[model samples]
Target chain A: MISIRWFLTLTLIALLVLVSFLSSLRGYRESMAEAETLFDLQLLEHVKLLGLLNPASFLFGNTLVIADSVITTPAELELSLQLLVVYQIFDREEKLVIRSENSPTENMAAFEPGYQHAEFNGYSWRALVAQDPLDGHWIMAAQRNDVRYRLAEAVTLQAVLPGVIGVPIAGLLIWWIVGLGLRPIQTLAASVRAREAGDLNVVELDDIPKELTPLTQSTNDLLTRLAMAFDREKRFAADAAHELRTPISVLKVQLHNLLHDLQSRQLPDAAVQTTRQSLQELGQGIDSLAHLIEQILVLNRTTPDQYMRQFTRINLLALVQDVVSNEFEQILARDQIFSLDGLPAFVSGDDTALRSLIQNLLVNASKYTPLGGQITITILQEHNKVLLKLEDSGPGIPEQQYAQVFDRFYRLPDAHHDASVTGSGLGLAIVKHIASMHQADIQLSRSQNLGGLCVTVIFQAYQQDNPA
Target chain B: MIDAVVIVLREVLEAMLVCCVLLASSYALGAKRIWLLPVTLFAVGGALLYATNLTALTDLFDGRGQELTNVLLLMLTGASLLFYLAQLPGVITQKTSGVTPALYASLIVASAAAMVRELAEIFIYIFSYGIASGQTAPVVSGAVIGAGVGVSLGIFIFFGLLWLGKRRCLQVSAVLLSLIGAGMMSQATRFLVQSGFLPGEHIVWDSSWLISESSLTGELLHALLGYDATPGIEQLAVYFASLLIAILLLRKLSVNQSLDVDSLRH
Candidate 1:
């Protein structure tokens, strides 16, 4: 039920985001740390340059050195120093000789050659102390902590920006790629869905992916087994019919000869007359058996798998007229009224199958209808579909039994009790199989006109390019 | 950026864990579709409404309203999950074609409740920082990362459960729900204590030194098991008690319900 395509796409995109973004975060942190170290080295280099400035020689005299004095006088000075470095210079004796305006008039750090954190001028600073080797002046250079942190963060953000922006694009590509990778599966499914129930052939796919090989193989194996099973069933029915036909024919002949011989003896005994009646009954039973075998063979031939599928365009009205002409004698013998009325409709189907389908419907109608009842056959072409309807004035089938009657060997409960109607229960089943082979639909309902069973077989009309 | 990622990740993971567990449970029960679309819409709509009215909500109950509301939501989610667990074993063992509407409703409610609070918090956090500081780039990037990890982990867990097969999935889901429900119950107690609804506080222990709440492993554990480095005595009592009740209910009710069904058939 889960769509492998969507699952793979979403999961892959998520994993990409997780891995790439986490790495970017790590890169940002590392870049910031590196930037911080580089800024510290710059601070050290600045302090060395200040040591070379040797500000003590320019002082000329003792300068007032302030202690614990916070610079709060000039707002502009503080604002400038917030983004710039603050520097201070001191003599070897720790007296402040020169200082930036933002710096207090005090030694920023102890007169030692090292870096240290100190609070002065109401701001925290990273101060580096280095002795002027030439003039022995203790020089200090410092940067505000906030300014350094801002610089590091800005630099790192620049490095991590591209990865953040590329995520949406990567997600689109992953979706497309995952769908592309799963194409074979979709193709296999579509091919299987397009097949007919009787078309149990091994599935053929081009460029099958390795992942789907086993699946296709298993499906093909099942199809092969099913096709073989159906073949066995068809052969069994056909073989039994063939095998039983010979013996039943011989029995019929032998009984006919024996009855003829008995009659030719010209005996007037009562037992001889009884023997004649019994022989007649036995002959009828044998005829019924022979009819059953022939029906079975027709059923097997109409099976879609066993059909040859050679189709031709024929006028359905013309075919129905021919079948009615052939079956009219039976309808007349029963004193039943018969009618074949319709428009000329062209249908593409196997000739023999269509003939069999029409004959079975006509026979079933006549057999079920009472004497002097009406049987109607109509063929109509409506909007590219041809509807073949057969109705009879007989005991109509129940609505619930409509679907069941199509099944092979299935008959109505009333049919069993009506000994007058002799049937093999294979008429409608054969009709259904042939109709399906011709790609037609069969619907059984109570006839509105004749008040009995109505069977409708709808077929797609044949479209001809050239009309005479 | 790191702070944004951590904050968003924690909330997303918590919500995703509950959704994944509920989804897995529905899958185990042979549900074809898990009402995902409706559930997501409900959760998101509720979260948006809650975030928009957050100021009004905070003003109520003398500014302890959010805590009290959170406590209620957490408790409701825990109870719903327990109810869902109660029906799982029997339905799974019986091999029903689909989950019953009642069980499905309970799962949807539990997932939506788990999600609304967490999603609202993320919305509030991201928008406030994005508008106030004008730092959209870093914050958005962090959120993207957090949501990615959380969603990915949830998908992994969902598939993992599926791979375990139906029976084992139900069993594991039951145990997982018990633990998660216990965690929610424990969290509810914390919120109550924070609102001063629960009396004086008592510290059970503090293991922040060993595993800080901000670390990666700690955050994952918090989302999965509701791990608290500094769990109070009240939270511990509620956690264990709720856990025990969930386990007992899942085992006893499912078995008894199966027996009842068999008896009725007889």
Candidate 2:
């Protein structure tokens, strides 16, 4: 695609050219007018000068010497020729008196009858007839049109040529100036081009043009975003590495202990029992690894760019009931009391993702709540949105840590010590990401009545007929 | 003629210098493969400049078109300068593997290539100018020579400063960039002024001793620097405000970097 710069430049140059041409034409026309006026003035002056030299004899041809002197002089001949061809003079009876050598070979009788003047053969001529006061004779003068037209042409070309030459030069200068002016943009592009993926630092383009201030600022804004993205990625990788290492280390240590016991040939009953316990611990470690891998997959899938969830109308009450039923095993094992309430609500979301979301929340509540703690899942319909509330009678999250819980791999400091209640720490982040993709909002608060953590997922409401 | 050629040559040489710097930097940073990006851009820019004979293009737009073109050119120059200034620090601080070094070298080469492209554009401009003016070869040739000398001198100055600054163990890239940015902003502002998009107060202050609007020198200065003796109010305001903003931004950046370093030390 042609960039805006080139498009703009070409458009500008074209506009300049057009303006130049019109102005040049106008200028040409003006000059032509001026030339005509000047020529008319000269003609009038010549007529006056001749009239002062006894116009009657000159008109009647009695003053032959004077007439020949005026017409035949080299200067006078040259001046007449320079002005145009086809000059003529006539008497009152319309008798031809004087004619230039290059005058058209037409019968004088034919032209004498009519006083009408017109242009012919690429030349415009003016004819004037005046009667002599002394002899009752007439005088006429006529000249060709080429001189005026030629002057006009010359004026037009002169007016246009500078624009012709100057515009391109100006254009080139403009291009160069544009290039120079765009030097900062080029510099900006180059700067951006020069950056490595790891380099998300701020761009400090100190001397940018005013026109490019917005561009520079936007570019800087992009850099800030990119930096944030990079930081997030780096942190994610670090957290993953740290989290994965613990289980692997535990498995390694258990295997090592079993090998040491076996090597000592001290296969006492106590030693056998200890080896079995070590094997069980290793199995548990492997299980944790599997769970971590699953969480990672979920985390990756939940990335907005990776996969888009299909939205369909889902019954909130039914979805909640299903999730609670699925988590009954864990709830029963932990002896946590679970209940559901509220009306049937409809929400727009991907069913599978929603189920996963609800299941995770329920599992999280089950795990975090103390034994025999009560869990309540409620579905409520509000104006334009459906709310799914999951409340647990566990130790409520600290107010400060509520926001942090949604961050990937963020486990509360106290939660880290409980190895019995293992978690991948990506559940809330996955939920948040999925929620965002569905245009839903999730919030954490202290359950006023439950005296525990209350997590709410708000979804856009769906009408019964318009499922989408 | 000399004037035209000199202008062409100057622009080309400057373009080349930038290309060289980018290519060298790419090589140093081990990112040689990416050289094609700048090369492609330069080629596109050159082809566009050459194919659209400046005169014909300007003629099409009518009288005010020339001023518009001038403004566009000025703005482009400013943008490029600012961009370079912004990236200087990163280029200096980046750790280069072989690939990175190559990339840097390519970037410098691309800059040089762009400069050469500009040179070609300059020649076209001069030639077109000559044809339009109906001037004889002598005049055209003189302009060309003058332009060439100007370009050579500009290159020399650019490199000389680079070398001197390097020798002094100072990263003059940032400073040089700022200057270039300031210059570009001034040019762009001037274009806006001439195009009537902004008021005549383009010049913040006119203390030109050698040139006044009534003098030939003043006309030359106006052509070269986008300087006007009596500028419009808005133009000056925009220019000064932009300059101040750029300076403040740079200062803030520097302060931030220093604070980061201090915290890191702790």
Candidate 3:
């Protein structure tokens, strides 16, 4: 589950930092260019001012413009050449005429009317020298090269540092903004989560984000589909009931009338026995119909999706014992030997669903087994799994029919032809559904000892904290 | 900030891209939700490895623990990817049930190993930079941006692959995925060379003049295709061997699927 909020916030912060950094880099280059241009103009202006000084001041061969600017000794802050301007006047013979107090008696540059670089002592200077045509004297004005570079760096840094410092503040803002943008989705999810279990109603959010509309629509689509399926299932049961109810009721009424008429006619003993036999057939038919309907209903209710919500820790041994007891009468009537085996085994599953599964297996065992047959039901824990096994001494299904037997209302040809045997053919289908719901593995095989059928269901063992 | 983001995004995107591809396939196979289990487990495992390394892990392999761990994870991921790639045979031929268990298990291992390796480095980098420096604003924002962009790009690639797959033969997607797997394994082989566990030549060819490996396009290609600026002979050999095996297996699976379809028609 990737959260949209996390993704968007991370993206927002990254974009901000990247944009800021690139912009600052561009600003640094532009600012340095601007600073260079400003320094050149100042250099040019200083050269002009020195050339315009009085010729006598130049002829005196004395220092000029040095008292106000020169620093024989200065404080740390005043050491920068940003405050110092030095100049010298040179004749055609390259002799020094007049200069600043501390200006070195050296040519800053050749008496050219353009900018140049020169060295004085161990330091480099940026200088512009201009010659006055009237007097044929050269005036050169210069400043330290390091001073200009330092100022350029300062200009760029001043422009960039704020954004660098702003990164964390921008991150916090992005976090809050992204959260605000995602609030609608969060609220929608919370509303959905807080709803009562099993309620698949369409969520009603007054305002929805464009991004989340599709999600909401899809969820609503699922709810609509579920609602439709539920309606169809309900209608199917009702329709089937309505269609079969009249015939069943009519049969019951006629059977009652026939029995009453036989008593009124004072029928002979042999005839009465035959009538009783026919009545027995009718009663069995009714029982099969009722059983079929009940199995159909149970199978529908336990459909994988429907029964997924109901899961609990259930004792397999107890459930098997109950089913065995309920089917004991039928087993005894057929003179079948029934045995129960193993200790209590607990598993995580739906109790009703597992109960139904147990009852069906027991009922099938009783129904299929011959007289004097043996049937065994067992429950045991193997490691972290609980296994439920049922075996009966009867004609087991052939290998080819195992898959077909799981289909709805499917009966073996032999079972269908047998006049004494009765079944609805839905027992195994219901059992399969329940097994699937609990994620239990079910298998059928020939009972090696019983020489008949064996059915086993393996369930995950659910440990319960019960000291009592 | 841009420099920081690019550095972090490079490593993050490689692992993230692999994850996106794996997750897409998992969803296609209808086993998407359960993948969270392995992802979380691997992340926690990586964190524990980071926390316990000096005190415990370095003792096991004589202080070469990191290299050893990387080798193990790479080998595991490679093997699992091979297993997963081969499972399409069962899916294509319908010889087994939907979403084979073997595929699920192998895919989980591959994704988990890859993710753990990548994420551990990221965690170490960010936390080791420290939070109390007051200088971490740029670092933090850059990391956040890198993470966001990497994941966002991964999503686009994932969807693009899926969309292209839907419009074309599945073999195309399979080939792309296999290529990525091969690329990773080759990089792992390079690590072995660097660690002195394998013999290698000096320099195969210097391609840096054409396109430096650290450039944006180079990084993207390196993540997707393992484009080394200078790959040695051993690395190339590993890459080709991995690709050959992957392609052959995918071809075999595709052939089996075709046969199944023909049989069904008959």
Candidate 4:
């Protein structure tokens, strides 16, 4: 997943760049418009100024040049002219009566009935024609469109240039600002990163950014969970190690004592038999320890995060039949009858994990059941789930003990606790984890018909659209 | 208007590429709880729009208000950069997961929001510029088109870079993020300087040989790199100092990485 910090930075930069870009554009447009309007206004003013100077000049058909003293001189026009290009006046028949020196294309005949825009001599032009009522002649004026547009272009450029520059700059600034803004997050990250794997203390929240409070809190929540899980695993490992070490140490001591006794003297028949019996018992104890160690390792591997087994679709009926058949010889050795009931069931899960889960259930059932006890395995499809039931004629778990049985190393007080019985107290826990990985649930209850323990696992049925 | 739209489309497309990379990486890792990625994107996207509005609102206020807002934004940007960098190691070293679909979706939404916000701002600027320039539609259109093309090109390049980076196993997400962050920081500084909160005459030294600010190309480069045409002593000094500091920090971080690698080998 993208880190929150990077996400925020990207977002902020994107926004700033966008704003800067648009603003620059807007600025350019505005300046251009302002230039155009100013040009139009100046042109109008220039026309008005000329009109005042020679009110009757057109009628008289004479160059009505007012003396410098009587009219506003051209020198006076220069100040206002700074914002405009060439301005001119044409008389009736579109003859140029008064014109600016820079004006190109003197043919006034081209000036049509309506206002027209033209580009000539590498310069754009806008001309207007109007009838002079007092003079009884057509009056026309045209100005270089370039001059107006150039000024507008300049203004637009000036206005937008900063934005063009500023956006990336703004983007950079935003990047830095975002960096500063995310300092708390960085601090949080640094604090987290600096931590040892075993450290799970609450992070300091005092300097966190307001925007990142939720994130920090969630991280802290995750840390709390990790800390708890870590602690649980550690304790479970320590407990298992301690329990198994004691049994192994005792077996070792007994074996050593038996060897020493044999070496010390020629033993009587009774003594020798007793020594042999002691050795056998020690062997059993060592076997139990080895079994317990194996169980603990299995339990550790089956933890949620560690369950990385590849899953595949398998026919539940076929798998169950295979497992039962493989165990048939063992079942017969114990004088137990095995029966399979129900139709073929299909499910998706890790083959190994599923096998282990079934194996544990069957073993548990077989261990508690008396000789000649019958074991039944049934797989049924109901609604949107596959339910597998393993029931045996054994002393069933109590209602309260059902939940406890799933706990690692938990053993019920009333249940069979024969020292010779091979059990590591981890089978049910492994089964629980495997079921969970497949999105399945397991329940333990008494088998009504068998007067024995019933272990049922229900898994969500795989649909074509939603693969497991 | 169409030009402005194009620019917005381009920038949004770039953001889309970054989002896509992030999503793909997450998916490859098989991470559960991936939905958070999209939700985060939406939330951040909304916040960005709000920030733009905040910028405008602050502008309406007195100088102090604007300065305050700018400072706040600057601080936010800086913090974000540091935070992102600090998380880089975890992201790179951790096993990849498949939690990217939701993340990508969110990023796309966020990027889209950012694009729209920017487009609107450009439109407003264009309208105002038009009014100022005597309502010349062609000039306004040209500017809009220029901006649009620029943004589009940026997006295309970003995606192209991402693709190349992916092929090289270069972690494009982090690199793009850093570049984007740098761009934002420069933009913030420009605003501060233009507004007169930051002094302009902070020139540390003149380094205009590579890109003189007077020419058009130089100006473009200056805009991109926070180059001052006529450097104020203060502006130049601040610029170089910041660059040096950033470089040093980066070096230190790289060194840390090497140290980590060495320790792992041991």
When only chain A is evaluated, what TM-score does every model earn? 0.85, 0.50, 0.67, 0.47
Report how far residue B87 has shifted in candidate 1, in Å.
3.9
Which 10 successive residues of model 3 chain A have the least lDDT summed? A61-70
Sort by DockQ, best first: 1, 3, 4, 2
What is the DockQ score, from 0 to 1, of model 2? 0.03
List ranges where model 2 is wrong by over 4 Å: A1-276, A294-312, A399-404, A415-419, B1-266
Tens-place lDDT digits, model 2, residues A1-468:
224465456555555654654465456557767877765655555544444454334443232233445686788776545665234455456656655455543422234423336555555565443455666544444555555455444544555456546766766765666566667878888988898554667777778889988988887899899779866885686577567777777777877776676767857878777777877777677777766766665655454432343567788898888877777998999888888999988887777778879988988988888898999988888898888899988887888888899999888887533447778888898899789877789989999878889999998898776655
TM-score for chain B of each model, two decimals: 0.91, 0.60, 0.88, 0.54
Worst 10 residues of 3 chain B by lDDT: B164-173
Tens digit per residue, CA lDDT, model 4, A1-468: 345565565656555666666666566667667776776666566555666656434442344333345548676556334434454466665666665545553654254544557666576677655555676444445666755666566656655655555556665776687678767767887888997554687777576777878888888899899889887986788577767777677777877787777767877879777877877776776877776776666555554443433556778888887777776776887899888888877787777678878877887778778789989998899998999999988877778777788888777674454444677778888888788878899988889789888888998775766566
Model 4 compared with the native: what TM-score?
Answer: 0.39
lDDT tens string, model 2, B63-145?
55655655554455445544543443444444342233433443433343344345546556655666655544433544533
What lDDT does candidate 2 reach at residue A159?
55
State which docking tier applies to candidate 3.
incorrect
iRMS values for every prediction: 1.7, 12.8, 6.1, 5.6
Candidate 3 residue-wise lDDT, A1-468, digit = tens: 246686677666666766776666577668878988888898788777776677564454465443445456556336543646678887767788777765777676777777888888577888888888887878888877867776676556666667767877988988999899889988998989997555768988988988899999999999889978887977798578667767877887888888888778877999998988899788779878877877876776676555665677778888888877777898889999999999988787788888899999888888888889999987888998888889988998897888888888888887533457888888898888788778888899999999888998988888675211
Candidate 1 local Cα displacement, residue A164, angstroms = 2.3
- Determine which window of 10 residues in candidate 4 chain B has minimal summed lDDT: B162-171
Tell me the deviation in Å of residue A143 in model 2: 18
lDDT tens digits by residue: candidate 1, B9-53:
899889988989788878766675648877899899999998999
- lDDT of model number 3: 0.76
